[model samples]
Target: MIKDSPNPPEHLFAVRPNLDTETLLVNASQDLASISDIAVHLAFEVDGAQRNVALGICRMLEGVQLLVNKALDEAYPAT
Candidate 1:
C-alpha cells in the first residue's frame, strides 16, 4: 500500500531547556573533545587528502573546544 503523505519526524534527542550556561558549555566541550579524538584516529586510518581532511577537522574541533572551555571558565570562575 502507498502512503498519501509522509509521517512526521521523531526527535529522539533534545537538550533540556532548563539547563544553565555552565552545563551547556561543559557538554559542548566534552562532545568536541570526543569528536576530535575520532578525527585524529580516522586520520591515521586514511592517507593523502582524506588524512589531511580528517586532521584538519581535528584541528578545528580543538579550536572549538578551547572556546567552549574559555566560556565555561568565564561563566563560572573558580574560587
Candidate 2:
C-alpha cells in the first residue's frame, strides 16, 4: 500500500522501467489525494479496505467532469 511508497508517481510512471510497483503506488496515492479533496461520501472500497483511496479518486473524477461540463454549459448558455 501507500505506507510502503517511497517516491511520488510522476518520477516512476514515465518512460523508463515500464510500469513498476512504485509507479502504481504513486498513481494510487495521487488519485486518492485528489478524490479526498472533492468528495464527501466515498462509496467504493478498494481491496476490501475501509478507505479505498484509489476508487474514491475515480468517483471524484466523475464528479469533477460533471462540474466542468456544467460550468461549460453555463458559460456557453446554448447560444
- For TM-score, the strongest prediction is 1
- TM per candidate: 0.83, 0.34
List model 2 lDDT by residue over 1-79, tens digit each. 3486576576555555677654554555566556655443453422445356655665767666566555545545665
Tens digits of lDDT, candidate 1, 55-74: 99988998989999999998
Give Cα distance to truth, residue 58, candidate 1, Å.
Answer: 0.7
Worst 10 residues of 2 by lDDT: 38-47
Pairs that clash in candidate 2 = none
Q: How high a TM-score does candidate 1 get? A: 0.83
Model 1 bad stretches (over 4 Å): 1-12
Candidate 2 residue 17 C-alpha distance from true site, Å: 35
User: How far out, in Å, is residue 43 in model 2?
Assistant: 12
Candidate lDDT values, in order: 0.91, 0.56
